[model samples]
Target chain A: MYQTNQYEGMIAETVSMRGHNGDVINAYVARPLGAGPFPGMVVIHHAPGWDEWYRECARRFAHHGYVSISPNLYFRDGHGTPEDVGAKVRAAGGAPDARVLGDLDGANAWLRSLPYVSRKVGIFGTCSGGRQAFLAGCRLKGLDAVIECWGGRVVQSKEELTPNQPVAPIDYTKDLSCPIIGIFGNEDKSPTPEQVNAHEAELKKHGKQYEFHRYEGAGHGFFYYDRPAYRQEQAVDGWKKVLAFTEKTLR
Target chain B: MCTMIAHQVRIQGRGKSGPEWFEVHEANVSYDHPYDLPLEHALNIDFVNETLGPGARVAVELSVDAARQLVKTIEAVLAQADQRGVLEDRPVAAEPARSPSVA
Candidate 1:
């Protein structure tokens, strides 16, 4: 069984952890102030880098009674604003898939080591982060739930394959250990409706426990309020679904 | 969508790094989500020198039409330069500036 917490306020701060072969990296952590244990979540930042919106997402998870940490995936590229580092990483052909997996493992370990954590941790991310969450959920163990928000390239075409991304996340569907929740927009072209359908089909074939919610009149990054793609109706519904899914699965 | 499509080119040029201009080694062009632009996607070009680190980059994100216009303008200017013998007058291998004041 899991423990309970009764904190009145939340504490959010920057912390450090070992990542990708014991290299120290910076991460933002947020959690409610409490005496009891709380479910943990690794909030993976999108390809935009660890920006303000990603920080808010971690805070939102903390507000919902989950201890959350958003790791700076591009820390190796050097730091000086999220956009700058993001561009550098992009220019350098992005971090390797193996490196990402190692960082996620480090995050998982960090969460489990926390004193107030229930050890029933989940992983969540938006955009590329969402894709990483799916990848980590399938490849890594110890996650109770996984939330993928508008992740693309899960079911990639031959033309879409790159040297860095040799395999599609859907190929790992058979090894998925926990329940997964996916939120997508019909207008998203990367993971088009057809691709989403293909991913769903693969999950079904593998008998994996998964739930997907597709929003109408929404496109990629509909949850980003600072961008033109923000869709309030769909974002609200998606948030509710995420909260409920984690509440049920992380217990 | 995280479009990982980028066309990279080896270039010898200059880019402003804060108050000073530095030699740039490469340019990356792609149509992807802009960091500050309001548009969902735009033509983003980054002038970078990896040796100078991540901060040594000058980036611009333009709309589709704007990007097309830029392409035409560049081509027209280069063609005009060639016609006027300006291209032939330029040095074949321009040397890097020894100091920031050279710009």
Candidate 2:
């Protein structure tokens, strides 16, 4: 798609919505200004908390003709900088999986309520959010696609499981309802190449529609430009794959 | 991978933030992604007093070598003080009780 001198407009802001157990929560929503209809995306922020990157990512999706919503998963953790809230969450052994899933469900519902929404909605997550996205595909309904980027602990040992994250995400593979795409760094420690392979085998056993793009010479959080893990070449290619997946499954 | 790795310990110290000093009641230590460090992961230490709000905190990120060196340096200094009879002989104390409302 190519266009010269095309008019462009967008609106980005924080909006309130009901999250898990009917609790009101804040969500960063970005939508194209002049849109007859647009696909929707629920952008789940990483474990670092609902910080700046996720907000910017919502705008990026809006630019690409999608309504994007990023819910504040740590809203109840209290008002503070991302680091402060994230540190608190980490100290508490992370947010409960049920609560996070409920929030994601609420975000999807809010997207569908929008007038310009195309009825197609997808979920994108990186880091801990990625793992939650995968869990959503299995546990939630109405999502068309799932984009899991470098989700660690998808395959967790029993001893590694916490009360907040009681069950291993791998156990939900057979329940996955939508197609999923995974982006990973070959050198990541949590989901090492072997773990990825194991996860792929589970998907294959369940015959799920899925695609995985693994990059060499990269490690966890390679897509994080602000961090030392950023790898331009791999990140670019991985993004292309992500967009392609969204196009095929969401658009 | 979001390591989700962190440990918290109670401590008693006064930390200065800007022009003001606040009591630091706890420290959180972890090996995970650093906000500003130029590495995949770093040993992060956060000195905090949650009652004083999120602003009453001091954070530092260091490489493994730096962290180990710092720990050894601290122990060495304490040992030197002990040898000089500058440190009082004290029994091990229990972890300080946190504010009941903190949770």
Candidate 3:
């Protein structure tokens, strides 16, 4: 396994890349500064926006010996505060699935193109991003691991379909090509416990390799430390599980 | 939960951006996670001008109860103003040329 000491150097910055349909978008990239190969991750930002938390997530991945990049999914809306961009995207009916998939494809490709990175790549996201990560694993090629953190609407009904989200991600479980891990809050109403069960059942029917960890006292976005629903115990445990899963699969 | 449900409508108003004011062309309202509020979820309202980018926005996140109270207060104020002839400017006669020019 790759190891790094506290004294090791790291680089984090905002970079640009071609996204879906050749649109240029900004992304936050962070990785160790050494000249060795390291596992990489695509840190998908939550629906709240590509804000400080997402930047911290990229840095955290680098601290754990992984190159990480988080593409600004709302960049097409033009530059501004995360909340403002998020509101604009929400007003436009949220980011389209095709665009997100294309952006993730670009991010994954960019990580692999780095000289110090290995071929192994994993993807993870929070809230709606979780769903995007899972979708990336299903649609994209060359991913080693997939992690979904309380992504809602993965198993949506027909009524839930909109111009933005036309189909459910769960519908693509049969095509999932990588080892996957899902962390969910049992109390989250968006993807209720029942939806998680249905998703698990679908995965099982497809005979896909997957594991799910649900927290008892947590609800949606339990990992958001600054929010009221944060459960420290659950978030810590979930983090440990996610690291272990990625290490085993991506490394 | 990232409740992706949001309602947007065209509006005409003005909002402060930096030291100046700009025309606000739209408003979006939703019940979802607030960016700055401590609450897990609240009724978020954003007044903005898309052409000015996301920075040209005025946002508010209000608790459910507080939002309801605000609606009630607005209705009460409007009713009182109508009774006091505060809304005497008839819309049919208020043409573009008849209104005071805005610089």
lDDT string for model 2 (B26-98, tens) is 8988887777888777898888887766656678889999999999999999999999989966744544433
lDDT of 3 by residue, A29-121 (tens): 999889869999999998878889899999999988999999999988776678778878877778999999999999988988999999899
Candidate topping lDDT: 2
Candidate 3: the clashing residue pairs are none
Give DockQ for candidates 1 onward, in order. 0.50, 0.41, 0.50
lDDT of 3 at B78: 88
Tell me the docking grade of candidate 2: acceptable
Q: Candidate 3 - CAPRI tier?
A: medium
Which sections of candidate 3 miss by over 4 Å?
A: A1-7, B17-19, B88-103
Instruction: Kindly indicate the candidate among 2 and 3 with the higher lDDT.
Output: 2
| Model 2 root mean square deviation, Cα atoms | 3.5
Order the numbered candidates by DockQ, best leading.
3, 1, 2
What are the Cα lDDT values of the candidates? 0.85, 0.87, 0.86
Candidate 1 CAPRI level: medium
Which residue pairs in candidate 2 have backbone atoms (N, alpha carbon, C) closer than 3 angstroms, thus clashing?
A: none
- In model 1, the runs with Cα more than 4 Å from the true position are A1-7, B88-103
Q: Candidate 2 on A49-97: residue-level lDDT in tens?
A: 7889899999988888889999999998877788878877776778899
